[model samples]
Target: MYMLVDCSNCRTPLQLPPGAKSIRCAICNAITLIAEPRAVAPPPASSYHHQQQYPPPAPWPSPYQTPGGPPPSAHGRKRALIVGISYKYSRHELKGCINDAKCMKYLLVNHFKFPESSILMLTEEETDPLRIPTKHNIRMAMYWLVQGCQQGDSLVFHYSGHGSQQRNYTGDEVDGYDETLCPLDFETQGMIVDDEINATIVRPLPRGVKLHAIIDACHSGTVLDLPFLCRMDRSGQYVWEDHRPRSGVWKGTSGGEVISFSGCDDDQTSADTSALSRVTSTGAMTYCFIQAIERGHAATYGSMLNSMRSTIRNDLGSGGGGGVVTSLITMLLTGGSLTGGFVQEPQLTACETFDVYAKPFSL
Candidate 1:
């Protein structure tokens, strides 16, 4: 007996004999199986087991679960890697970067309750050869952050150092510039570009895990290559824009969550030794962020953003502190604004703006 069938892989029509086990399509040169139905229904646009455009369904509900749905739970784990490069003798050295990383580690451990051992620190003063914030160390540390990450895991990647922009040769960046983080060996090994950063941290993550990147550097907006940049009005509404039109930048939420906060716009620079405060020195943005988080106030994305912005404008004056960074979360009861108005902006890049039933921000 003979039968007519279409190739499942290439979708080409073929003439076949009964009991044929497999066939090869001539047009697309794809092999397809002729077998009994294993799946009850056709998969969606993509399969969870395989990689595709939109990520596959996650195994658990995310932080901001839909209302009345199952509550968000921590089934995986939490880890962090904080890198602060002083670049001691380098021409691009700064004073406040190491301070920023240490302070953030304090906040995570004392306040947010992150495990001390789970936190990795890479700085210039490290005696261990492996802990130095060189290009190789930073890259390895990034892998360590997301390695073995599973659903409900929370991870933080904080970088405080010299950030610069290079001419975009790869077309992955939309603004014709590729943001870079200068490691201690940047002069020799070259700066780590945004593309490499994304491929390292964002692409490998599975759904349900959350990554929060607090990038306190120059030209850091969209540094992680997150797909959606969230814009919020002074009132309460928000709109998300594609970070790049032609680029297929990876979003962490394929089966996990990724939200990156950058210190400034791609064309602008973040301040290091700000003249605003009485302290020795600190990244302007990092200082304000620490202050806000330390307040122990219940923080949502909106509330935290306003608190940081407001604290800076009030104490530092306009442009006194060049620290303004933004992040993305699913949803919470965040509805507040900075009192003093300024054009100083921070950028928030999310995966899909999944703002339905998320909870308040925590560690």
Candidate 2:
């Protein structure tokens, strides 16, 4: 079958014929060899014993290896709990958020070396029937994230769903606290306040723990605002636009060793599509994110933020485009002290984006 291939050398997609062993892009002059899948017949029921006789070898390094005989204080191994809620009660398309979450889980497991057991997946089928990711599930997930994390541990919270915002409770016009995310069970009469979410999740995080939150929903652009936007002209780089600063607005917790990535500006609404397949439907921001991290562009948290912004800005365009509008923000808690005598470095290698258009798959 034909697969959409993005050239790591050129970062462009090319279409190839089905069953073709190799492909060469006419535009970029890049060549990619396709792997052919080998067919294997299923064993009969009586062959179960034969299969058991030749078990596969154990995976190496064991995702839970302690570096150099478990350092003092038993700094626990890094852990992650991924919650992906894609299917909405009122939506027609298959929620790609779930697919995005699963893809990240694969990256975390394979690339980041996070143990598979540490990553949790909460989909429509696995979600609790009684306590959906409504206010209840979000709260529970927060509890698990904050209380569950320990000093020297890093946690990542990625949410992909519909996000909405409202005026702050004080109702001060100049205050300008204009955006927030909407949970599964948000109602106009009773909205989920950002304060509640911060109080429950952000504020209570254990000291010395690094937290990274990625909110891939709408109305999240307020998470962080850049001082200005620059454009590269023939002469040089020039400042083109500046996001007007709004004073007296709440900027979440800044001194808590936490960073947030929001989806869109308060005035903008994120696009959720139904026509694209799950693997490819991840918002442009997320799609670019996977590409950047895998392609070795991002190493540190700060660097990751820069790469993410640049990719979204360049690939999706600034003002009007069919992509997710996302922003990244980081707040330090206690200025980051080494609580466990060991600092963990995030591991994210490089890989090209999986281009769907060139592939034979369809929605």
Candidate 3:
């Protein structure tokens, strides 16, 4: 006799002989035990077996323990890649991008205590041929960040430069636009579309790893393409909105703790300004971002968002687009309209909603 069973790893169904102790799934190639079927009918088809998705070669132990165990502390390896494109001398010359990249490196090293050597910096100023922010270099850097990542490892990717949108041929984007990152050689090497970004960075990520992205660029809200778009209210309530079902190879979440802080909405443009202190030029969103973290040290997601909005309103005018946010992001981030203010609203997108109140700002 034979019984139908789902692959323990990838969920593909297969037939198994009676009394078989175990079998390897041809689909995901995962070895799994053959257990008796449930006496009762299986739950709804929608029911999930998330653990089955993790194939053999059990993941490394997490750096953190449950609240019942040790106090909160980060362990394991940490790595980051900071990409800033000045686009100098090109038709799309951008000022302050190199500075943005350097500042981010500084923030991670000084504030987050990340080691300097572990972090990769790709900027226009770099004379090294391999370290330039060319399309190839950027992809390689992303690969470097995810490589050797273990449970509880921390990985970060920061891109401060130009972002553009193209017609979505794959139907992956509900808005019919595929957001792209313009490399220094984009005119020659082509743009890095969100699909490539997702596959390169988000797809291979294992559970228990932490990937944080700070994208200071135009149309960067979904740069990392996380599955869930979480929205919050002034009252400090949050709701997870499902990412739009799209065609082809990319979906946002990877079941890992992936989060992004983007400068603007898909239909909007972020600014490169030096208005904050008049001391140095940098991206407006970026300036407020570092400042908020520096001042608050540790604020809830809601508090951080509020602090950024308040800081920009009180200090600088809207950058690039001259408006606060596109209607899509305004509703998504604020759960309301832009009101009368004109300021670019930063966005936080994640794989899933966790304890927003408890998770600190820097993480």
Candidate 4:
């Protein structure tokens, strides 16, 4: 005497045993109660059973909500982890890196609908005490990137700090040496090398995930006065230095897919204070690069970098400041190829009749 039930909402059919009192739909995840004709529970003697069959209240929205609501399509969202090192203790100046990161985060989240949980931020005050070998706050970020990153996910690594170089290790081939990122607690006794960064975050990333690294420091063969151009393995040692590269371009042997955006060139100093009101700025190049992207002028990475270089040169009143903006961005595309999508797609307003997607940077 099994009772057969069918869901009216999703139209999925279900089977309930004679004694079964309730059943849930398999398609829409909705619940339905099964009542045997003779086994129906009577309402209170004075109450009407029709009142108990009232409709349910509407459900709330999911965490992943878009401008109108949940996206009409089931598209994998743009996931990102942004880190800005604006304030440092022993490290070099990073006046605007953190601010730049914050702005970039806002663009990605609000404009692109990237989940708030997906974005990670690190400042001078936040540090992971347990992970001593790596940068203070970077360890948590690395942990999340390594474990959570999936194929097809896009990752953005933005750092506004000092960059240096060291003689290539015996087995290393490219560039005859390697570039390094100076962590917050980097000690002169044992410099933190870029290899560690690669090992922790870059190397472990899942396949099909697009990796973009923006470095707003110097790191050519030689920085201002410090000879980062040619040096021995000083990974564990730290030297208080200035004029280092902010970013570099490289890939893993297994075809590591990565693109980097550098702030300045190797020999020049990346300006922290801007000419625009001297109102502290964040990763100079990073800020401008994002501005172009958010504006929708950069349909590709190459276009975005070109726009950044032009804008920076115009804004700062100089063409070459030794920042690594172009080099880092070009590296992401493997020596220049278009990548990056138009974040916002235009739609007519409730009262308007024209397409605003063509409008200048709708997002």
What does candidate 2's lDDT look like per residue over 226-257, in tens digits? 22222222222223333333443332332234
TM-score each candidate. Answer: 0.70, 0.54, 0.70, 0.53
- Residue range 128-231, candidate 3, lDDT tens digits: 66678987678656656665466787898999999999897756676788789998988866788887687657766666788888899899878777776766
* Model 3, global lDDT: 0.67
Compared with the true structure, what per-residue lDDT tens digits does model 4 show for residues 235-354?
Answer: 212222222323322223122244455655443445553323424545556656665675555664444555565555544334323233333232221221111211111101011111
lDDT (C-alpha) at residue 219 in model 2: 62
Give the TM-score (vs. native) of candidate 2: 0.54
Report the C-alpha displacement of residue 335, candidate 2, in angstroms.
44
User: Can you give the lDDT of residue 27 in candidate 4?
Assistant: 31
Candidate 1 vs candidate 4: the lDDT winner is 1
Write candidate 1's Cα lDDT for 186-254 as tens digits. Answer: 887778888767766776667777888999888888788778886665444667777754744334444
Q: List the residue pairs that clash in candidate 1.
A: 64-357, 64-358, 206-255, 206-256, 207-255, 207-256, 208-255, 208-256, 253-256, 285-323
C-alpha RMSD for every candidate: 14.4, 22.9, 13.2, 21.4
The candidate that wins on lDDT is 3
**Candidate 1: residue 29 lDDT (0-100):** 48
Clashing pairs in 3: 226-252, 227-252, 227-253, 324-343
Query: How many steric clashes between backbone atoms does each model show?
Result: 10, 13, 4, 31
